[model samples]
Target chain A: MPKETVSLRQAACTFVMFLFGSSVIMGVNSEAGQDSWISLLLAMLMALPIILIYARIMRLYPEMDLFEIVEKVIGKIGGKIVTILMIWYALHLCALVIRDFSEFIKVTVLTETPQLNIMLILILVVVYMSKSGIETMGKWSVIILPVITLVVIFTMILGLERIDPTNLLPIMGHSLGTIAGGAYKIFAFPFAETVVFLCLAGSLRKKDSPYKLFTVATLIATVIFLLVIMRNLLLLGPAVTNAKYYPSYTAVRIINVGDFLVRIEGSTALNFILAGVIKTTVCLVAASKGITRLFGLCNYKHIVFPLGLLAVALGTLLYENIKEAFDFLEIYQIYAIPFQIIIPVFIWILAEIKVRQDKAANGSHSPDSAQTDAAG
Target chain B: MNKKGKCFIIVLLMLFLLCGCQGYRGLDEMVIVTGIAIDKTPENDNYRLTFEIVDLTVPVKEMGLKGQVIESEGKTLFDAVRNAKKRITKKLYFGQAQIIIVSQEIARNEDVGIIIDWFLRDVECRETMCFIISQEETAREMFEIEALTHPLVSTEINNILELDQEVTSTTLCVELYKAFGGLHSEGEELALPVIHKAINNGKTVGETNGMAVFKDNKLVGFLPPNESKYYLFAIDEVKGGILTLSAFGEEHNISLEIFENKTGASFDYKDGKVKVTVKTDTTVYLGEVMRPYAPMDEKEINELEDIAKSELKKNISNSIKKVQSEFGADIYGFGNMIYKKDIKLWKQLAENWEEHFRTLEVEVESEIEIANTASLK
Candidate 1:
């Protein structure tokens, strides 16, 4: 079969959507109070180095996903153990995002609707997206990303009358330690969460540079997050923003432009759902890919449906209620470290050493043969 | 089955799941609530809720839109709301609710936080709905008055509160979100407009005027309409209002329409006491001159401007002092200003802010400009 490749632009769009996934609705950690924009900026700076490392791994193994790379670099036993860990992370992350979306809907709009229904419907759509292949998912992201950006910008413009810049006063009110903690939470969440993209990188066209894709997506997502943070802070003030479970929805609730454009928070709901669908789809695809590699299956698509069902079931049984789900986020940053930072770093370092060794071995025989050997 | 046929069957099944039949409620099945009035029962501590649901039975073109009131009693506000269904046939939808009126008794005796908690927590209730304290004996009485201009007294009160801010500046429109913020914030307190019944053209109507000041979440005192204007000026909430000035040794009164105004408060903390300097820049047009106007020279205009400035300064200082001694509530948000200006200083002062606010010294400086003579000169 011919290889399936995603264009560089499509991959960047998908990565941006993944970053915006749950953060758009859940909002960033507001522990920094009105200085949350500062925390977000700090988070982007901290995420930059890690994002570069992820891209470097993709560059080293140009045609292989992280699962294939891990098996190739580590021995068979070590690779299987690592793959099981990664598969668990991907499935848990998928369930978590699914739960966040369903909880938001249940709390805000569809109070009477059962969460199981919401999760099942969402998982079905995600499973279909995953079954159609990464190329379809990438194209869908390319089309849906602009709509999400426009909706966010539109709400920001309409809410301009309500913006009180003084709410952001005493800019450095938080101690550096508190702001750094908030930045760490933000980095683990939506920024470093892009580590999932390593599993999808195999589909990226060989001619396109992973470095450019990762950097561009991160910069764009950072700018959008900064605007969202400033918008919520300026409109709601830090006290109310921190008091609410969903600050973005609460902030957008007050956007009344001459009373004509009242209750435009529905648009915010749309933005979250669209971006969330892309994120869950990415996670589902990654988990299925890991499962296929672990079991030595011929195709990942064959088990996509069952994995999607398992994710929905896990989402439903993840927590007793919405409050517990939110409480989980406080420790989510620490929980994500091993997967987002530790394992990725280990793989990148091993890939680099292996590439150097391969180059040394092939240089003695023929310079042109190094590329073919690495591909093999 | 072929692959295409199986794919089609799955897509059809998914589409069936996408329909929101389970949670869907038709418009006719729900009664839209335009206003809510909460009162405390005279005999018990239970809440008495009066919801003014929109009367959709009458045709709009002939009778105009109207509201029908339904009363329910329960232990909590949400309970009272659900109990309202006993009298009505459908669920109360608050998505279109424009005003919430609470009785003075509830505002004075009960914790306003407990009363507003239900609205804040409910999904259907919009945070933008205006909140008001009724000056009448019972908040429901405010709804009993006939709606002369509009079919619904709640909508009429909403319109008055919204429009009066621009024309009178005697009341501040506090939305649910702003009230929630004020209740939770350490440095600032909540203040809402006061609504009452008045006879207009031999017909009773609901009118919104004056302001109710709160110390924390409990009502402390009230500011009359005239004093409320200066309160608006002190807080920089004045968009437009008439500032009447007496000229020629108090013989003739000249009403100056405020064109634009800006107020800024700066704090100076020293010797365990804080001093606030409030500076206001105002531009006005000579709206109505009691005496016939002769085209005045620049010196005359400057003199008049100084008179307007000193008059405004005296009124604003007096209003701030009245609130300080009478209510001790920082409705002007001076404490909030300090909190925003310097967090460390605020941390020191936030614990006993009320006592500090009562003893704090305030100085008012104002600059007024007569921008236009209103075509009289």
Candidate 2:
């Protein structure tokens, strides 16, 4: 298999773009108040230790990719079980992301276009991205990264005119418990999506270490998340911001530059679609690789098309409608923790334990060949 | 390697080709409705939906200043809208539409909640438009009447609603989206601006001063144009308006052009008692005094200030009581205020909001500044 190399800059850009797609504003703002930005900050901090588990796994298996480490650590039956769980998790996440993107498109761009049609169009892009491999998807991260930055900057700038500073007052107006609660749902999205990147950690230019790379990505996503929540809060104030759907988008719409640049509300929606596509591309590529490694396939591209179709079907049936989808997130988020954090940590633990035991039992295991062992 | 990649590329190319011929029809194809009026048919059983659709390409200047409205009658508002399809070639698009006016006759009779839910759910319907109740005339007539100026009459109507913020505290600038919030909210009743025709010569006029009051979503009665002004101010909608007062020897008509005004209510809950304080801060431009406060005496100005405060306070209390008793609707959003200020009070008063609001003592305090005297001073 050809090893791919993605730059640190590509990883940051892709993370920023992916956060834009994962309903960052929709997840935190609708329930959390104008202080949703605070929730996001807290959630990112909360998810840090969990993020470090993956970092530790990458540290332990510096030379091995996610699939390689799983096999080396869990030993066949256990490894395959973990690999299958991860594959299912990625597939489900890819489905959710696809659902969010298609639902957005259905509500914003193509109201008459059936949900299935939107999912189909989105799935086509995801499949093409997956088939093209990490090298090409990383190229997308590089391409979409700048566009996303411009969008965030422009939206924040335009949205500034409506900023009533009073909305920011009485900091931590949300009950401590409520704020604490929203943080986890908010954290699972952009923060947890970082877990999938472990599959491509080895593909990053060797010996550079993923520590700086993952940290940079998290920071970039955090900043965008912060700006979106702040802009929405300041524009609509506390209560109205919570009542609205796509608050960030409407906040942008409120950006009337002398009435000429009016109603570009859907621009954020466009940015989300573009960002979501890239994120799905990365995840799709990772999921395909996970499957290929588990099946011992020489190439992963063959799985991309079939999995892409499955993603479309899954998105189409994820929930009955947009409101229900977010409602499900409020409760069903409890179910996502194991996939995003637990499974990865489990792999990391088993990998580290086996590595330590193997090294202790056979101090010169690699250097001592069978001939040397028998001769001794 | 090249052959395999090329085959992949060729397949993608074929797919792109398959999707290439699809084209976007311009948003213009959909009728851009600016205002919608739901009125009961004269026969009273059917529905009359009047659409104030502005065709951008056709200049209003050419139409002698009147915008076009397509009227359709059916059993339901949706039916009326769909029936209009037969008359116009363009598809009806509600995205840019800003005003939804419900005729009082129908508003009093029908479930505005059900009618509004359709607009709320529709993707294209604009959320920030003014929601109104037709005072006396059919809303269809209001849609047909030409405004004094402005190509799009509804835009002018919306401007009036926006500008009313200075003179009045309660400009029911609440849109469909806000209306939905007020409905789903714990203890709030809905309110919509009331519109009526003020006739001059022998002609039918649709633009006039008056607002309909509703208990929940049903129209209960109408507020006089003056109360509408005070209510707008009470609700912080006062953009600017004139204040007229009379004394024994002097007639004081102060054109109080308000620049900035803030209306906020504080709900304080205690043992066996719940009270709401309605406070307003207004900056006003004083106008020409009929009897000479000659050099515009500070005493006279102070007197005028006191008068303005008392009048505003009286108006607010009266307005509150009328709404509470007549319609039992909390249009002023005391529920929302309490929800923000005291969530526990909101929970207690969430049910029977109107009754609780009526029973709850309302104390009104206002600070008015005579920012400037007309240049005549």
Candidate 3:
């Protein structure tokens, strides 16, 4: 089979949508209360260097996914251990997204529907999409991205009447330590979680630098996070915003424009569907890639179905109830730190050492000698 | 199609079968509950819940609309609501319910937090449901009153509240989540509109009596229309209302129509004590004048403004006093204001806030601007 590639535009769209995956529903760092936007600002700045590390790692090893790059940088035995961990993280992250979305639907729209059914249907779609490879997933994201954007923009515009700007006052309401802690949580879940993209960076068509995609996507997502957090805060006020589990849903539910446009909260449901599907699909694709490489399989598509089923099963067994799922979110920030940040940075350092050592060994490094070094 | 297409189609079919069409409710199979009224049972501790269900069988062109009121009793609110399924043929859907009326007994005896817990947790229930305390002797009797305009009592009450947004607004429409917010808030209190059946020209009609104040989760006191208006003013929520003032030595009455109202609160911390200053800016247009009305000079207009300002201050303070001294409930959200402005000061004052609030000094300032007199001028 020929190498499949996605356009840079599609990659950027997929990245932005993935950032919005669960942030749109759970809200961004609401623990900071009225100071959530401050936490978000700090989260974006903190996430920049890590996301840049991901791009740099990809640029260093073109056409090689994290699995391949790790094997080259680290020995085979060490790389296999890291590959297993990456695969497990990918599978676990995919199930968590599935559970997040299915729990939302269970509580909000479909009360009596079995949670397993929701997870199954979602995983089915994700399996089919992942099987189609990265190009199809990227193109699908590009197509649905605008629709989701318009839905969000229109909901924000319609909600303009109910926003009480006083809700945002008394900024920096929490202690600096608390606000920074909230920033760490935000950085881990949505921002640092982009480490899964390292497995995807190698799939983009060879062209411009991947930095443009990461930086531009992060900026767009940060703006969206700010808009959503501020809108929920202003519309619901701090008291209600903290009381309700899903503040954004409740805020949109209160939008009564001449009684005609009531219940526009279903737009939020649409947003969760688009982003959640894309996020889960990317995770599944990455996990399948790791599994295929681990087993020396010929094609990654063969494992997408089984791994997708495994994700659905894990989602059902993840938590007993919605409260437990939320408790997991509170702990997930710390739980994901090592996988999302520590391992990637470690590999990047090793790769950097290897690149410099190669240049040193060459002794007359230039563009021509670099080509020879690559062939060697 | 190839094997992959066939397998994809099979999986789609299985998916639909798995979902079981859970949310598919046909119009005919579902009953739309527009309003609910709850009252304490005469003998037991159970609650008698009445539901105002819309009858969809009626045609659109017919002037006469049909609705049914069903009553049931259970130990809990959810039990009572679900018990309706025994008598009714279709499922009772509350997504359209706009009003929830609780009897004075329930408001005083039952915990509203527990009563509304079911509504808040139900997926079909909306967060915009209005909480109303029935002033009628029997709450079910209030739901039985035929609406003069709309087909259902709830729709009529909803309309009345909407229209009340304009002239002399007496009651505040408190949504379910806002009520929940107040109930869950640290030092904030909750207030809901009171409704009752009134006999007008021998016809039973529903109207807003005043407002009910809640301390924590239980009903504590009631405020009349005048005081409720002032409470809304203090909270800076008055949209449009008429303010009547006396001028020309009480001989002539001038009514000002409120157009814009802004309320701001500032905290003054001095010597381990807190003082909340409430400043209100009101923009009004002259609406009515008694007989023997004449163009007034700048001095008289200033005098009228002063009278309006003093009147606003007195009524607002009186409302606060009644809620503070009598009920010891901080329904004006002064504590919330303090918390927003200065958290450290609020934390120091958080304990025994009710006592502090009762004795705390509150300065009410009103700036009234009269835009112009209407066409009568």
Candidate 4:
């Protein structure tokens, strides 16, 4: 069969990308104090030019995915080496996303539910998106995105009653270096993780969609991040947020509507599910597609069933304990920098130089291809 | 459609269908717990567990305050709740629970630490619920009172607690999570709101009298209503209040009504006796007066401000002295103030901070001003 194509709404695609990007890099609560949002915004703003670079590369070779581009950029063997590393990075990320989502659900809502069952349930939903192609993931993203936004917005409204506003005092309170360190953590986990989209960018009917969608989605993500961070700060204050692991959950529990509505701590659990699923789906798609390309398969479906099974097994057996799981995320943070940022930076620049030299050699179309208007 | 694709759609439909209907409670098996009361018995080894549960099917208007409060005797609190589960038809649902009252006798006992521990370890019990100590009556007796508004006394009790939290500091709505945080600080003593039964013409009602003071796990003493306001003010939570101040030889009391309050205490390390400076920034909106006082003049305002400051200082000082000297408990949190201010020195002094606090030099400063929406020119 022709590669199963997915028709996803631009908004949903943006939300999927935004949530996927943020989840992997940032912590629900970290040592950065109140400036966690600052790191998120900086990472997002920093991703703009890089998103443009993705568009530039995609426009140069409209029909080819990332593996083809890398192969073309540095010949077959050289391309295979980088592509193999990229493939590992993608698969590892997909596994981590599944692990985190399953672990979170198991702890939060599905306390009595088996871990295997939870992982299986999550993978079951995600398989629909991955196997059906981008269209299913995108449509679900659109359907889920609006509800998620409204839930968050509703939560923000409820939380406003308890927020003291003084908790945000002593702005930029910590040293910039500390904030930068935190920003780097966020950059690795959430922001930089968007590199997976590079795999999907070429397949977009609108190639420039990633650039436009990335910016808009990043802006939306930044606003939500600011609201979440601000809500936690206002409700818990600096002292409490620094003390608790799930500050967002505690923040919602305090929201008593004139003494009637009580203990809706489950709101954060809903959020983790909504944002976490989209993120896992993106990872699954990226990993499955990369493998199909790497192995020279005609269709990506053959790997989907096996990979989904692998995800279930990997998620179930991955971390022996919660501490090990956290250690894995932290280690991945440092390790992900190379794949998410440095390599992308390297490929982007090389692609730019090649475009320049190709312009010198082949003339106009090479240079013109990178122009902002011509990019999509 | 392919074989695998058809299988996937059917599976999705089944999963949604299964999760759509989840079981909460069966009609005959569910017993809804409305109120929980833990009180100490006269014997050292025994305690009383009181559960006020609602019959699920009854409508609030018809059942108004008619639920039975089953009392079970036990050595430990968790056992009491566990025993009650055996007595009721409906499951003990705590999701609608408003308050947990520990008798003054229970609060003062060292064994109360176990109760706080139980609160933190359980997933069913939330930290956001209000805690109270029945000052002069049994917690069960207080729960027995017929509610004025919602015949469901529990609903009324929860609402009154919420309303008072906004208006007065005397209604201390302390949560378990915050109590955990406060107790974690080695220097500070713990205090919870005091609930008591008010008998007027033999019609008893649930009344919050003051605050139940504690040193770690054990209750120390109770603050009277007036003194508890100062505690609330010190915590910067008193929303509004009225205070009367009289000169040493003045004939009558000059009352100042407070519109806003800002309170802070700082630790000063000067001598062997640690010094603490308590500050209160208050805005007073004066009510109708007694002799020798004008309601809205600058000269009167200045005089009122001075009197307000002196009165507030005296109230706080009295509470501090009573807390330090009578209770001999470090309930004022002087230890935590020192810790956050000087962690290194605090580590050295942490062990003896309680004794060091007795001689700690404390200065009370109150700044009172008249700030109204309209100018009194």
| Chain A TM-score compared with the true chain A, each model in order | 0.96, 0.92, 0.96, 0.88
Preferred candidate (DockQ higher): 2 or 4: 2
- Better candidate by lDDT, 1 or 3: 1
* 10 residues in a row with least lDDT, candidate 3 chain B: B14-23
Off by more than 4 A, model 1: A364-376, B1-17, B292-299
Tens digits of per-residue lDDT, candidate 1, B284-362, equal 9988867665776778778788889999999999999999999999988998899889889999999999999999999
Residue range B141-170, candidate 4, lDDT tens digits: 777787766766665666676667556656
CAPRI category for model 2: incorrect
Candidate 4, A1-376: lDDT as tens digits: 4543443255335455445433622264457676666666665666667656655666665545688778777778877777788877876776777777666655445555667767777777777767777666676677777776676678778878767654453456566787777766665667667777777665566434555566666667667767777777777665566655456766777787865776677766777766776776776777777787778887776687678778778777779865677667568777886787677777777776766677678656654545533543
Q: TM-score: which candidate is best?
A: 1
| Candidate 2 lDDT over residue span A1-376, tens digit each | 7777777677667666766666654575746685677788898898777777787777776646788888888778877887887787778888888888777767666766677777777788788877777777777888877787788889788767656665664466568788877787788766776787777677676445566766777787778778778877777666557756666666665576765777887778878878788778777777888899888998888988898888788877889998987787876577777878788878877866776676668776644222223322
Chain B: TM-scores of all predictions: 0.95, 0.84, 0.93, 0.87
Q: What's the residue-level lDDT of B220 in candidate 3?
A: 88
lDDT of 2 at A233: 74
Computed on alpha carbons, the lDDT of every model, listed in order, comes to 0.88, 0.72, 0.85, 0.68
TM-score of each: 0.96, 0.85, 0.93, 0.77
Clashing pairs in 3: none
Pick by lDDT: which candidate is best?
A: 1
Which candidate, 2 or 3, has the higher TM-score?
A: 3
Candidate 4: true interface contacts recovered: 0.03
Please give the TM-score of chain B in predicted model 2: 0.84
Q: lDDT, candidate 4, residue B242? A: 69
lDDT of 2 by residue, B154-257 (tens): 87777767655544534556666556555655455666776666665665445646666666667777778767776666566566666666642555545566
The TM-score, computed over Cα atoms with residue i paired to residue i, of candidate 4 is: 0.77
Q: What is the interface RMSD of each candidate, in Å?
A: 1.3, 4.4, 2.1, 5.0
